[model samples]
Target: MWSRIRRAGRVTALVLPCSLLALAASQSAQAALGSAPLTPPSDASVSSRVVQPASGTTQSVMRSESSAASSTSSTSASYTVRETTFGNGTVVREYLTTSGAVFGISWHGPQMPDLNDLLGSYFPQYVAGVKAVRAARGNARGPVSVDDSGLVVRSGGHMGAFSGVAWLPSELPAGVSGSDIQ
Candidate 1:
């Protein structure tokens, strides 16, 4: 019996690394964070990437109006947002700049949106920051915030209610403010 347990431990040790490596490889194959288009090409892709058990329930588009800080002139292209709702009534909103960069993303629903897919390449940095915060706070509960140089992410909620917002500070349009993310 002891020998069987030892063999099982060895197998697990070998399998764990391989599984982690495969997961990392698969994630790296996904599109990059700042470069990829904010929304997926179709609802199918959104369901697979953003939320699980998503029904592709609702999709809506609206123009956001933003005035330049230096002048009253406004541009419609800079403030466009696409909102997609999952089966569980969770909504994921993607905010884009005039140049087509996805500067901000927000989500609210019963379950948390997959950060790996949402943040893309920046997810690693965000994860590292979260670990640091958790260690420092000794696993305190509340909203989680990461204010890295270029990235700002805040997410918190209890069961049946989760919401999060993430944005690239430097990527925001000149007239846009972080508070504008919503």
Candidate 2:
């Protein structure tokens, strides 16, 4: 009986080692075949190759020209909030873009008690709400841009709310009206 027990212990140890070796060998084989081992390029090397200029003098000149152009364009495209009060005690503030885009709109006063509640709410539900409106009108296809400022309701296409105060786009597809939402 003792001899049989000793033989069983030796067999168990040998089998365990063989199983571990097989696993390691299989993993190495997979890596060698390019099936698993892969690595990303180093960040320093990637940036240096992509952004290096032909010459130092040319890089300085390019940077200066870009800065000047950005300053000029930013000044011309600045926007301001334009407020208007309707007879129904509702105050609407429209943020007009100098480049001709109504970037934002805000409403307040007695008509909407929780007017300022959504001032900083980043409600993703608003996106679903707008898409639903668009889908219901059967105009879900074509070019559409959606913007959420996390403080205000902003979109690219016509989003209806108040009378005559449609979210009109400066450039929309032909035959699409400011009233045709969706």
Q: CA lDDT, every prediction?
A: 0.61, 0.31
Q: Which candidate is the best by TM-score?
A: 1
Alpha-carbon RMSD to native, per candidate:
10.6, 24.7
Residue 27 of model 2, lDDT score = 26
> What number of backbone clashes does candidate 1 have, counting pairs of residues 3 or more apart or in separate chains?
0
TM-score of 1: 0.63
Candidate 2 ranges beyond 4 A from true positions: 1-77, 112-127, 130-182
- Which lDDT tens digits does candidate 2 get at residues 52-158? 11221211122232232232223323332333444434445443333323334444444431212222222344556568657877966533334333222333323
Worst 10 residues of 2 by lDDT: 44-53
Candidate 1 per-residue lDDT over residues 95-116, each given as its tens digit: 6554445678888987676788
